[model samples]
Target: MKSAKAKATNYKACLALEVPAYVAFYKAPPEFLGDDALTIEVKYQGGRTEIQKITVKVSAPGGQQKI
Candidate 1:
C-alpha cells in the first residue's frame, strides 16, 4: 500500500475484559513475490502508538516441500 492508516477498535471480551483490537485486509501487489518487509503502525485508544515490523512471505503456486 502506498499509504495506509488504521484505527483501533475497543472490544469487550469474555470476563468483562476490555481490549484493543484491529483487523486489516489487504491485497499484495501483483508483481510482488518472495519475502518482503512490512511495517505497521498501531494506535491504541489510550493514545499509545507503536511501530511493528513483520515479514511477508510469498511463494509459488503448488510448490512442493521436501520432508
Candidate 2:
C-alpha cells in the first residue's frame, strides 16, 4: 500500500455545506501536518455558543470516502 505522505500532494482539500447551518469542514495545508485537525466554533446571536471539530485524514484513491 502507498503511504499517506506519498499521495498527500496529489489531493485537494475542500468543504461543502448548506447555509443557515453552522457546520463546516476544514482541510489544513500540507505544511501544517503536525496540527492536522480542523476547529470550528459557532456563536449565536443571543450569546449562545456551539463548537464542532474533527481530525483531518488523508484520503486514498479508488474508494468512496465521506468527508
Candidate 3:
C-alpha cells in the first residue's frame, strides 16, 4: 500500500541503472585499433536474460590484453 506518488515521488539509484523495457547497446570498437581484438557488446532485446560483463583491460609495454 505504498502508492500516492510513493511519498511525493522521489527515488534514486546507483551503478548506472537504466533499461526500462528494451534498449542497451554500446558499440565502440573501430578507431584504428590494430590487431582487432577489442569489442564490447551488451545488447538486450526481450526474453532470455543473463548479462553482467563489461571487461576491458589493455595494458601497455607490449603485453596484457583482456577485452
Best TM-score among the predictions, by candidate number: 1
Model 2 lDDT at residue 62? 45
> Which candidate ranks first by lDDT, i.e. highest?
1
Q: For residues 8-59, what per-residue lDDT tens digits would candidate 2 score against the true structure?
A: 2324452443223333545555554333566567777899998867665555
TM-score of model number 3: 0.25
TM-score of 1: 0.49
Model 2: lowest-lDDT 10 consecutive positions: 1-10
Residue 62 shift from truth in candidate 2, angstroms: 3.5
What count of clashes does model 1 give? 0
lDDT of 1 by residue, 1-67 (tens): 3434444455444434434456554455786667766678987778999998776676565653221
lDDT against the true structure, per candidate, is: 0.60, 0.49, 0.42
| Superior by TM-score: candidate 1 or candidate 2 | 1
- Clashes (N, CA, C under 3 Å) per candidate: 0, 0, 0
In candidate 3, what are the lDDT values of residues 1-67, reduced to their tens digit?
Answer: 1212213223364434433343333443545332433333445567555655555553544665655
